[model samples]
Target: MTSDIALSVKDLKTYFYTNNRCNKAINGVSFDIRRGKTLCIVGESGCGKSVTASTIMQLLPTLSRIEAGSITYHAERGDIRIDQLARNGAEIRKIRGAEIAMIFQDPMTALNPVYTIGFQIEESLKYHTDLSLKEIKKKAIDLLRDMGIPMPEKRVDEYPHQFSGGMRQRAMIAMAMSCNPKILIADEPTTALDVTIQAQIFKLMDKLKAEHDTAIMLITHDMGVVAELADEVAVMYMGNIVEAGSVDDVLRSPKHPYTRALLDSIPVLGQGKKQAIKAIKGATPDPYERPNGCSFAPRCDFATKECDVMPDEEYISKSHRIMCANYKAVS
Candidate 1:
């Protein structure tokens, strides 16, 4: 692992078991989150972005379990390795809030409707910090005020329902940042908000990152967001990562066909003669029925008999990689 790696996920496989059959939700996914940088996980819906994030945070449901892989956290205590599958509740509890903090996709649902925003933020501080009640309250308002909430002194007393969707999202940011964690895992943080508000949230995150040097793992489907915020990008399809690389390498010159298709599907704004975006043809295959060879072979335009042999990872220099037989052959 690199000296600056804050978190390293190696060959992660999280599966769900039922009486009927077993399902693979995250298959052999791996990436590194470096200190003080952003790594964006991008894919269409049901691509296992949330599952990967939840697995790392050890928040998956009882039915689903981590089948393989090692999550290693490098800290002052040295490397803390956990087999996310076998970790006890107490161990997960320590890692969840103290070192890693998560911001959910929906603030309204994640935040308790009964509690005031101040109470929620203060609660996080109280759990993680040994501050007095007065200090916690002051920090809570400072967090809200720092997130640009208007009159945070007054609004901190308001409930979740009282704030607009955007404000609620900002308040969620306040709560997530209250502990000043080393790693912030945002699972679709800007999903429901409008574009302008989405922009603001990202800008705020970027500002905070610079100020605190926090490592961020952003899980989302938006390529624009990936282009804007990420230093590196990981593309997942049907629970498996097909490509991973630096943002400039992956976005500007994608080796995998799936990555190309995803970027091509985004509609262009200023090209005046409006035309429909070219979307990928097939829906993601069922998790229980994933293909035997390459998971993305069914949808790839460049797939071949080689794809039926199960792809292998090919390093395109030190910074770019793709799990594809064809891209390796041609590139």
Candidate 2:
């Protein structure tokens, strides 16, 4: 809605239709990513975090469709409603991997094994720009170098398998950043890496953001990662954003029960006594069989009869909001 907002997703509902049953993967998801800031989406597995990223990138599979809502991208040219762009059409093509890029969860799966890493990076540049093959190749190697790959001139010519996991991840980042996209969507990019490598990846992303002023939509379940990079955090549950605010507001003064539960579950360093780790009770509900009312009401400790109907989104502050009936009582 504002010039500073790079991307805004409003009430997005992405569903999978199979056997006449609809699996609501991302129901009523909304958030804003501002230019040069990182917005982290955090939740447990199957909470629709990754699906939300895929939807924003217009990368949803055949069975999936955006059933409702809008994804608006604020470009230098003008404001564009991405949801209105035809799937995989020329308009969407101009945005995906160019103006808006995504780094997927697994580089091995996302990268083409048969193609050299340089070719892959160049492919994006070639598609989006009118650069010559030689220019694209030179830019590709430069991107890899920027990503901190050793001797990127040599490594760029190597295939995905030749590089280590960390290297491959870096290559993926290089490819995503090749076009200097306005928005970068990274979906659990550090999921398979060790703590050290994960830290390195985040640091690289932070450096990229600083240099490029890129708005980042980071989808991760790790609270630690969220702590490291997020300016704002959105805690999603059962396809709904139950809590959202500045990182400190959401992490330190979380009002929603779900947010509190999530924070309490994170294992702390030097946590004094030998107490068992805290974990949220109950599993995520089945997507196809989501219950009426609050999807988390079944597991919420403070659920009331009022929870049988989804509560109105209550603002704790201008930037802090929660969709819980008992937030006032709990906080």
Candidate 3:
């Protein structure tokens, strides 16, 4: 663990056991999240983007278990192997909200409908900090204000149903930021909002990153969101990262066929209406019976017989790496 890196996940393998079948939701995934930087995990749904985040947070469901790998959190106090910690233990409980916080995709379900917004925001502060009730309430209001909510003093007393969709998302962000976490994992924070709200959320995230220097692990499928917010980008397929690099390098010069296919699927701003959008050819492989080789090979235009075996990671540059046997051909 280096001083700059906030967290490092190496060879992570999270699987779900159901009906005597092992579904490898996240297999051999690895990445580093640096302080004050945004790492976007982008791919189609079921690509294990959310699973990776959940694994780090130790919030996986009962049926799923971390089969292998290490999640190392570089704390100011010391380096801690999160994977080794007992899930729901006192140590992980302290670190979950205080050192690292998460903003979930659906605020409605994540938030307690019965509780007042202020109370919910204050919950973490009460548990994580030694702050007095008055101070906690004040901080809750301040966080809401920081999240661009109007009349925070009044809104704090309101319930989740009283707030609009965007407001609920902002409240979620406020709650996540209340503890001043070193790492903030936002799982599609703006997925349910309109474009305007999405832009506002992104702006709010940018402001928070600038002010707090928080390491953000953003899981999203939208390339536009990745383009707007990511400092580093990882393209995942079938629970594995097929390509990763600086956002500029990954987006502009993608090496893996899957990465290129994802990029090509994005609609261009001024392209003629007659121009057809490109879509990836095949569905993601069945989780219970994943391909023995490259997971994306079935859908990859550049795939060949050699792709029948999993390809080792190859570095295109000091910062860019791709896991594709046919990368050179595509390049």
Candidate 4:
């Protein structure tokens, strides 16, 4: 892996086994997260965005298995193949919170109801560092203060329920950053927040990334968030990445049919009054019943007999690539 690349995922295939049928949650997904940069993964629900995040964190359910692919983690000292590490091994345990941390979608469900927020943060600090109890508590308070929490000394001792939704999200960010992780995997981090609060969270993440030199792999469906924070963007459809490039390239000049349809569906302000948001014609295909050729062919208007054979990803520029048979037809 190059020095600029913090993490690289290649040919990742994660599947779930249930009742003798396999659900291909993530098939051949690949992307690179550059150091001190944000790579946003955007797609509709059930399109394997979250699954890819969880697979990187090794947090999948018991029945799920990574059938093929490798996740290379570029540590300061050397590179480690994360896929080959045992789920509960010593190295992975150290890597989870210390090297890579995840901020989940929901703070209410992610936090433990019993423990105080300070204790939770301290737990992460203790696991990653050999800090004493007093030092850990002080660091926990510092983290809360850094996250803009008021009365950090007192609020740090309160349970998760005592904090507001935005506060709780900040607390989650504090915990995820307690160890100063190299890579931060945020899965829909602002899903449950209001618009104003959402902006604050994005700003906080950007500030932290700049200060800590951290790489961010953000999974979200919000194009607004992508526009505000993403350096690179990858569009996923039915478990495959259809297009990937710099944020401007992917959002401004989308090549794939699915990518264009998604942008068209976004409601543009000041375009006109009383204009209904455009909706895609069909829903995503069932995971187990995906098409043999192009998984997106059934719903793609540009799909034709040529699409019967899956198209290889073609590079349009040094950093832009699209997986489609007729990218030129649309653009």
Candidate 5:
């Protein structure tokens, strides 16, 4: 309900129910995203990063259900609350591309292989805005051009196959912002692109965030991206947020064992004096069957018998908190 907070997620637990088992993808995930800032959700693959992103936008798949959560959107129009799982695809449709847009990881899979780029972008514009087809086409082209897609006017008529990977990603960005969404959820957007293109895309996103005042929820495993674009970083492990803080505080001097392990794994240029790469020991636990206590206990070096209890999030500062059993002792 706060004006400054763009999105507030409380007790978010999204689950995927199969015939065999019910997988708790996001377990009690909670966070607040302030307006016009990037909140990077970082974690390993299958740690419920994408699910959490989709849950925020109320865009979960048909079979998967939001087990529990209250996602509130504080918008200029009004405060909208969504019981993410309970809301049907039709109700959630009102938010997607209209208020809360999502830019998926792969543009090729996300974008229509059949429809022209212009048509797809224009379709969203038509649905959200009262813009006519002709007007929407113009807007779509402008958006494409803005995203640095070459000859967007001509390229608008082409299908997905016509453009390069970077260009296609740009098109996806254009499509995401077609309706000028307030909240843009980008799920590992720079994954497959090369370094140059990745830089370009990152710059483009920063530029767009500045110009549009969009609140971005960037979900990725890349710590480099977190350092560059994140105003705040929420480190997830298993299915829960293990640490949340400003980029400066947590990234510079991570308090949690999981976080420290992650940062230590990042290969630096001239720091070979230290030991070899210290990656987290254990693999991410199966979402269907989490451990008895702290999700990261299996891998946490600081973990003790006390970690058998549900670890409490201890606040390091006003802006930083770590949910670990041994943060104080480690410090």
Candidate 6:
């Protein structure tokens, strides 16, 4: 791995087994998250974005297992393969909230309803640092203040239900940043917020990235968010990255059919009301019965007979790659 790369996930395959059936939640996904940069993983629901994040965090459930590949965290101490670590082991536990942190999609469910917001943030500090109780409390207040929550001193003692949707999300971010983690995984952090609040959240994230030099893996289905916040972007479909490149490359010169479909679906700001949105036809394939060839072949408008055989990844440039058999013709 390069020095700039904070984490490298290679050919990661995570599967869930239940009732004699296998659901491939993540299939051969690979990406490198560079320090102080944002890598946005954009795709529709059930495209395995959250599963990829969970796999990296070693937080998969009992029935789910990593069947192949590696997740290498490029730590200051050494390169650690996160996929090989025991789920609840000491080493991973230490790394989970300190070296790496996550802001889950929904704060209402993720946060403990009974505990004060400050208590939750302090819990991470207690495990990761040797700060005294008083110090921890002060730090928690400071974090809440940093998140733009008004009157942190009072709000710290409040429970999750006491805060609004945006404030709760900010509190989750505050808790996640308590330990100054190197890599931050935010799975649709702004999904539940209003437009104004969403803008504030993105601005705050940008500020945090600049201040902490944290590498961020942001998973979302919003291409608008990708265009705004992503330094690099990966278009995932059916558990695989169909295209990946710098934001400009992928957004401006998208090669894969799915990527184009996604871009076309986005409503442009100045486009008149009569401008028709092109929604991608067909739903994602069933994980238990994935197609033998290209997973997207069933939905692609440009799919050919050759699509019945899986296409090898074709490099458009050192920074851009696509997994389409007819990328040349399509481009």
TM-score of 1: 0.96
* CA lDDT of every candidate: 0.87, 0.91, 0.93, 0.93, 0.87, 0.94
C-alpha TM-score for every candidate: 0.96, 0.97, 0.98, 0.98, 0.95, 0.98
Evaluate residue 238 in candidate 3 and report its C-alpha lDDT on the 0 to 100 scale: 90
lDDT of each residue in 67-155, candidate 6, tens digit only: 99999999999999998888899999999999999999999999999999999999999999999999999999999999999999999
Model 4 spans with C-alpha error above 4 angstroms: 274-276
What TM value does model 5 have?
Answer: 0.95
Residues 1-331 of candidate 3: C-alpha lDDT, one tens digit per residue = 3788999999999999999999999989889999999999998899999999999999999999989989999998899999999979999999998899999999999999999999999999999999999999999999999888999999999999999999999999999999999999999999898999999999999998999999999999999899989999999999999999999999899888888888777787888786677899978888888999999888889879999999998888999998998788998
**Segments in model 2 whose C-alpha atoms lie over 4 Å from true places:** 274-276
What range of 10 consecutive residues in model 5 has the weakest lDDT sum? 83-92
Tell me which residue pairs clash in candidate 6.
none
Cα lDDT over the full model 6: 0.94
Clashing pairs in 2: none
Per-residue lDDT for 208 in model 3?
87
Off by over 4 Å in 3: 274-276
Candidate 6, position 167, lDDT: 97
Q: Cα RMSD (Å) between model 3 and the true structure?
A: 1.1
lDDT (Cα, tens digit) per residue for candidate 2, span 1-331: 3878999999999999999999999889888999999999999999999999988888889998999999999999999999999888999999999999999999899999999999999998988999999999899988988888899889888999999999999999999999999999999999999989998998999999999999999999989888889999999999999999999999889899988888888777787667566788989888888879999999888889989998878888999989998787777
lDDT for model 1:
0.87
**Higher-ranked by lDDT: 3 or 5:** 3
- What local lDDT score does residue 221 receive in model 4, on the 0 to 100 scale? 96
The better-scoring model by TM-score among 1 and 6 is: 6
Find the 10 residues in a row with the least total lDDT in model 6: 279-288
